[model samples]
Target: MKFGARNQITATVGTVKTGDVMSQIDLQVDHPHGMSSVMTTESLQELGIKPGDKVRVIVKAIHVLVAKE
Candidate 1:
């Protein structure tokens, strides 16, 4: 999941923020944007992620093309 950034950066997962129940979990990414976005609890859970660990981030842009639809 490594993306277009240095592989030496690291971050820690802090407290979980939930709003109005069933909300997306807010994960604290230490290094911020120049590398990757902080992942949410739900996102992490979906990807089987955990705290106190290093994870790779793969970034990509999705585009949709239309032809007189």
Candidate 2:
């Protein structure tokens, strides 16, 4: 799936932490920096994500629109 104009990186779902809330799904990705990522129910489903499932991780740089009020 093309998100805007940026490319998405293909990665595998290494680990997952499912919280008490059904909507809370924390995922640990096998990144070069040992970095992890956060994903929501909608996003997870969109990627067809599951434990041991493969998914694409898109990294985007965004500017802050507004300061914390």
lDDT of 1 by residue, 1-69 (tens): 546533333454444444343433334465463332445546656765544445444333332234694
Per-model lDDT: 0.45, 0.56
* Predicted structure 1: lDDT: 0.45
**True lDDT of residue 17, candidate 2:** 60
List CA RMSD, all candidates: 8.4, 5.5
Clash count per candidate:
0, 0
Lowest lDDT block of 10, candidate 1: 57-66
Native-to-model Cα distance after best TM-score fit, residue 35 in candidate 2, in Å: 2.8
lDDT of 2: 0.56
Pull out the clashing pairs in model 1. Answer: none
